[model samples]
Target: MDETLREQQLRMTRFIRDPHANLPPPGIEARRLAVYRQLFLGNVQGLLAGSFPVLRATLANDLWQSLVEDFYACHRCRTPLFTEVAGEWVGYLESREDLPGWVAELAHYEWIETVLLLSDSTDPAHEPEGDLFNGVPLLSSLAMPLAYVWPVSQIGPGHVPQKAPGEPTLLLARRGADQKVYFSRLAPLAYALLVSLREQQISGREHLETLAELAGMEWDVLEPQATALLLDLKAQGVVLGTYSG
Candidate 1:
């Protein structure tokens, strides 16, 4: 590209991204610039609104618009894909200190749906009906165990928490075989077990024994309860049975 043309393109992009702080390119008419600015900002806002419906509905209209506008102006997104815009928006919210403490957490909680829906990865090779305790347990590639300080799942227009609760919230987000995403609350032990499964490729029995030690209980006593929990996870599609490979 020519040096002058490159500069002109940069100016136009800067103005479109943040009209208040930037001047339009020299040849563009103010009427045309306004159209371009609104078009770009509207596209960004629409993507974010769809991705974070709960957050969008919880905040006042003006505040939400302002927040989106600020993100458009200030954030330098790493990706050009529109589908990934929500993730970028979450990163922007996480970086900001001016917004409410729960804003980033809520945005992230909402963004997980988009991530799982668009993910291309498939579950690893494993026996769907294999024994979970004897073989290495297989956690579905699409299943994610998340811990948030705020009750992100319960937050909405009707329920805005003033302060975070004493205990962190443990939630499971998974993409089912039907191509639908689901969210559910998780008990602390359940969360720990899932996290361990995700982080370490170990047998279910070993995982349970470790958990029993952590909880200060004998393996014989915890085995029944842990086995039941594992069975339930398998039924829910969160646990894809024991690892076969």
Candidate 2:
């Protein structure tokens, strides 16, 4: 690109991104610049509104608009793709200090659905009906166990908690065979088990034994309950069955 033309493009982009702080490209009419500004911001806002409907609805209109505008103007996104804008917005929210503590958590909670829905990754080779205890248990590639300080699953316009609760929220977000994403609150034990499954390629029996030790319970005592939990998870599509490879 020619240096002069490159400079012109940069100036226009700055003006479109942050119109109030930037002067419109030298000879462009104010009306034309306004149109460009509105078009650009409107597109971004529409994309984000769809991505974070809960966050948008939870905040007051002015606050939401200001937040979006600040993100648009001040945050330089690493990706040029519109599909990744929500992730970028979440990253931006996590970096800000002035916002409420739950804001970033809620945004991340909302963004997870988008991430799972659009992910191109596929499940690894596994036996959907294999014995989970005898072979390595397979966790679904789309199943994610998340822990947050705020009750992000319950936060909304009418129910925003003034402070985080004593216990951190544990939740599982997974994609079903129908291609829809779902979120469920998880018990601490269940959360720990899932986290362990994700981190360790071990048989279900071994995983249960480890959990029993962690909980200070006998393996025989925990086996029945833990086995039931694994069965339920397999039924729910969270567990993809035993690892075949």
Candidate 3:
């Protein structure tokens, strides 16, 4: 709380954030400061690398390191837990304008796996064979519906597409009973229905009827397809069960 101590603390943090730009606080040996700086920065870099493995592989060593440095120096994390660091990194990426178009989407695709793995909630017990039309479909606690401009799931070392496809990518990722996260590509209509199920507490029949009306299709045409899709999702553990009452 002393004036001199406060100034020293500020200088030390600045040095930790950007050691090349700012010198260590007065009377601290450069060797001692270098060790602290390397230890902290290296740990962050390693964590980011572990969190976004495919992103790191796509960008290669130098570009990935530069991106990590920028993230470290610019972002002030809200939570102290290391498990939440990837979310902070994703938020930081969202704010940056100079990153490649697919970078943020790719980072998010990688982050969701960690999010599901660490989630404390479990899927509600429901009959896997429940009817979707007559029942209220319950989504898995660990499942998430994600729509992205780029085909983030397909991007990696050898298959980075420079431009987004004509249609936006739709994906459903869920953690199964085996505790493994799996991703499934979804049709745009199917993705919309899944998102609607999450956002609106409507019966599966009503949800598909609304979607059919919005798309100018009759219930007879959409119902069978929607029912089949829901059944597949239920089998996949994305949709646990449905409530008819």
Candidate 4:
């Protein structure tokens, strides 16, 4: 590429990021640039706002925009396209220290819903037999584990809800047949077991044995809770099938 073209391409990135810059084009005039500027930021803000409605509700519009702007400028996205901006936006939130800790956590808490909803993961296609706990392995890939410092589920339009849950919240972010994402809470032990199962290639029984040891719960004692959790995981579209391997 020509040096001028390269620099101009860099500037286009900077311009889109800055949101107050001139639109770069022969056809884009001053008024056109202004329109594009607002339209561009508005689209980003709307997608982010949709993902984080509760967090947006916490801040005034300008404040929220400023927060989004800060992340927009500071982070270099791994993706080539602009439409897939939320991943970088979420990464920025989780990394920045200048922002309020709760806000960053809340932003990540919200962004996860969009990530799962838009996921293209198609690896797990095994049918559920619904006997998830009969000495069979259980896991959830479609239903992912998330632990957040801020309890984002409770807040809504009407009121400023509690900042954190009474305990650390273990959430399962799952996608439905229609591709909508839903949040479900899990017990800590259950969450740990699910995570271990999904991560390793161990047989289902071996995974439970390892998990039980890790949790310091005797397998005999935790058997019921573990079984119940596996059944729930199956119902929620996480477990693909019994681990025969």
- Total clashes in model 3, counting residue pairs 3 or more apart in sequence or in different chains: 0
Q: Any runs in candidate 2 off by more than 4 Å, and if so which?
A: none
What's the candidate order when arranged by decreasing TM-score?
Answer: 2, 1, 3, 4
Question: Which whole-number lDDT from 0 to 100 does residue 67 have in model 1?
Answer: 86
**lDDT, candidate 3, at 231:** 77
Query: Which lDDT tens digits does candidate 3 get at residues 26-134?
Result: 9999898889888999999889989999998999688788878988888889999999999999999888888878999999999999999999985556656676776
TM-score of 2: 0.94
lDDT computed for candidate 1: 0.91
| Candidate 4 lDDT trough over 10 residues, lowest sum | 126-135
Sorting all predicted structures by lDDT, with the top scorer first, yields: 2, 1, 3, 4
> If both were scored by TM-score, which would come out higher, candidate 3 or candidate 4?
3
RMSD of 3: 2.2
Q: Which pairs of residues collide in candidate 1? A: none
lDDT of 4 by residue, 1-245 (tens): 89987877676656666745544644446676667567767777887887777788886778787877766666677887655676677777767677665677777777777777767766544435633444355464567888866566665556544445567778878878887888888788777877877677565566677778987889998777777766666666677676443
Backbone atom clashes (below 3 Å) for every candidate: 0, 0, 0, 1
Candidate 2 lDDT at 164 equals 91
Residues 1-245, candidate 1, lDDT per residue (tens digit)? 89998999999999998888987799789999999888988888888888899999999999898889999999888988989888898899998898888999999999999899999997778898988888998998899999999999889997999999999999999998798999999999999999999999888899999999999999889999999999999998889888776
- Kindly report which residue stretches of model 3 are placed more than 4 angstroms away from their true locations once superposed: 1-3, 122-131, 243-245
**Residue pair clashes in candidate 3:** none
